[model samples]
Target chain A: MGDFDFSIIAANWRFLAEGLRYTVQVTLTAMVGGILLGTLLALMRLASLWPLRWLAAAYINFFRSVPLVQVILAVYLILPLLLQFLTGRLIPIGADNSAYFTFTIFEAAYYAEIIRSGIQSIPRGQVAAGYALGFTYSQTMRLVVLPQAFRNMLPVLLTQTIVLFQDVSLVYAIGATDFFGAADKITQRDLRPVEMYTTVAVVYFVLCFALSRLVKYLQSRIAIIR
Target chain B: MNYHWDWLFFFQEADDGLMYYQWVLSGLGWTVAVSLTSLAIALLLGSAFGVLRTTPNRWLIAIGDTYVDVFRNIPLIVQLFLWFFVLPELVPRDIGLWMKQDLPYFVTAVIGLGLFTGARIAEQVKAGINSLSRGQRFAGLALGFTEWQTYRYVRLPMAYRIVLPALTSEAMNVYKNSAVTYSVGILELYFQYKQIIEKTSQVLEITIVITLAYFVVAFATNRLFAWIEQRSRVPGMIAGGQGGK
Candidate 1:
């Protein structure tokens, strides 16, 4: 520890910030994509035909069962090969653009189940009341039930977002030069693995701690009795 | 056909792809080993945290809160990298060098999974404990049970029953996250698939194998947990109307 130089991090602040921007972009894109996909699956799982419900279940189970690393790896590595075999030419790729796509697809699986549980937590009576008022099932879900379900889900949803923020680091596995990747590169180049990695870890720790605190604050403000 | 699906290529010794499938089996073994070890570690720490959260002590509650918050927010892979690569570098020079040379991959994988999944199990366990009535605790006290005894007998069983589903999900998550071990070169299932895909360009076949492996493991594990949940139901809870078939 005493032998480690702390000043390298100060020197690399701009590079770190660039990495942070990419991390933030990936996190935001994946979260939004995950929520939309999640909501659709939630609705399908609830009142859709048996086949649709099974399909929804299978999607969640498959995604959640496999490791996110596997999912990310498959998208970046294996999918291209499979596609190249079908098509005449291989897909051209840019690092960040391809990375964002992989992250969204990877995160969508868990988020779908989270949303489904949130919807399931809603009372059956409320849906029946909406129907009694002559609202179609979709209309009732959209107008009344989903809003309440979202409220019920807000705390867990926030927690999931924080998880997503953390998961953005995994993009480094596929060559995206995100914050963690930058730190790893620094470690490799400078032979100061401890200093570089610790600097990044502290940065990650501060961000995650702040996010969890924010979630708690939000939960208190919008406390649901149930 | 420009792209013939040579399924027979996989079964022949002349084809250089058989080694990749063997790697997948080894990777699967590592995944299972890491999952089981981490599950044990997570359960122990989580149960202690669960007890603390329900205790009358304020500081203990704060400690549990801090633990869960810190670990839950960070990505598991970052944690793994920090544990395997960085932590060793920061320790005493002699000890650090020794660790870098000697630390087992399985040990690192378990620590990674345990720390991440423990935070989740702690939340589930605390929720389980809170769902029980105040009267149950009082009843244990009235029956002359010690604090530890009360926990061992009255509190934990019901709490386990209450949080069975959540624990099952966490178990699955830990199993899935174990694949992150590949980045540190743990050679888990995904690692095997990557090697296979790279070697023979049988990307679809190997990808399908990994997917099927996960599905089979998950389904069997879920069924096992469901059976445990059924068996662990409180006497009247299942025999009476509350339990679903």
Candidate 2:
């Protein structure tokens, strides 16, 4: 029943900016950490050692099966206790840190699957060519396979990143003051839930839509012609 | 800091005369109900829009693209809040009043979750349809069938079978995404987990149990869909590879 007010948002621009900063910070951190760990996991799953493959598969399956909210809650609550038990001292793994770690760990499973497919898409003859030219397993993966895989899967990776950006909002469950959370706090304070939520929704839609279009463009550009 | 673990705490009855496990069961019921209902909506709407996107008509494709872009980009929690709070105010006054007064939280959650997920499904359905060879469509048309009948009998069945793996993942995603409905105050499993944690302060045990419950649901859904994918798969049709978690 209340009229929309842009002035409320204008007055609180600083708070919203801080929230956006934190959201971007967590997203970038998670993206880097997730890709590193996920690539390792994908390599492990494709490893010659059965135990290594089993361990990697189990980790991916367990994480993939559970909801991200559960992972966020568990990490937020349990990581501190785990640290305390292990070291007999309580470390302050704050909500934002917990959110970052959880996103990294949870998203790795998804990225692992994507990266695995990318790696597989490379012809076996290429790997054999690497070995045939006197390369170790690690050297072959690094020098040839991984670079090509990254190129092949760039679109999927960026698509997942867009999904990750949307998921960053879920950090609100733990009160991390991401963009959505910042808007939510304003709503609570201003008693203008409709305007605040509508603004936040529009912001999210624009960001995600733009990112998806970029992904599409990348997909078309880097599309490896068979 | 010296908290003792109470593995049996879930078995203990609360003052309300129900055990915590019972609360979880009821929460699971709501979760399943919400997920399945939303999935039904997603399939119907998603397929419609997906098929529309594949048509040669420009306007229909624009409508499909707009639907997917609008629904898929916004986060589900935001959508849920919008449905629960802003939507009623935006509609006609009488209907708005009825929505605010008579519409249940479950209905709101379903609409929010369904439409949001329906967008994702629309993308998958479109991809599945596009993956089919043009020969399949021509073959259907050449068989003296109308376009609608050709789609229903020939193209759709094959498309659904091809996309079964992606559909499986979407089914599991719907169940997981249902957790977001807790934002709108639906007493689903995640909501119940928060409630129990607040009252009991047994965060670790409760969270572990909730995680396992979600895992079981997702795992079962995965297995069920994998089975369907196996049965319905065409012998050598691109292997029906799984994608999109």
**Maximum-lDDT candidate:** 2
lDDT for residue A215 in candidate 1, whole number 0-100: 82
Query: What is every candidate's C-alpha DockQ against the true complex, given to 2 decimals?
Result: 0.60, 0.61
lDDT of each: 0.78, 0.88
- Regions of candidate 1 where Cα sits further than 4 Å from its true position: A78-89, A124-138, A224-226, B1-4, B9-18, B238-245
Residue pairs in candidate 1 whose N, alpha carbon or C atoms collide under 3 angstroms: none
A65-158 in candidate 1: lDDT tens per residue?
A: 7767667767776556656676867876656677788777767777777778888888889999999999998899998799988988888887
* lDDT by residue (tens digit), candidate 2, B1-245: 57788989899997789999999999999999999999999999999999999997899999999999999899888888899888887788999899988889898889889899889899988998898899888998899988888779988888898778788889999988999888888999998998898878898788878888888888788888887777776666666544222
Question: CA lDDT of A13 in candidate 1?
Answer: 79
- What is the model-wide C-alpha lDDT for candidate 2? 0.88
Root-mean-square deviation of candidate 1: 2.9
Candidate 2 docking band: medium
i-RMSD of all predictions: 2.3, 1.9
Q: TM-score of each model's B chain?
A: 0.91, 0.94
As a whole number from 0 to 100, the lDDT of residue B123 in candidate 1 is 92
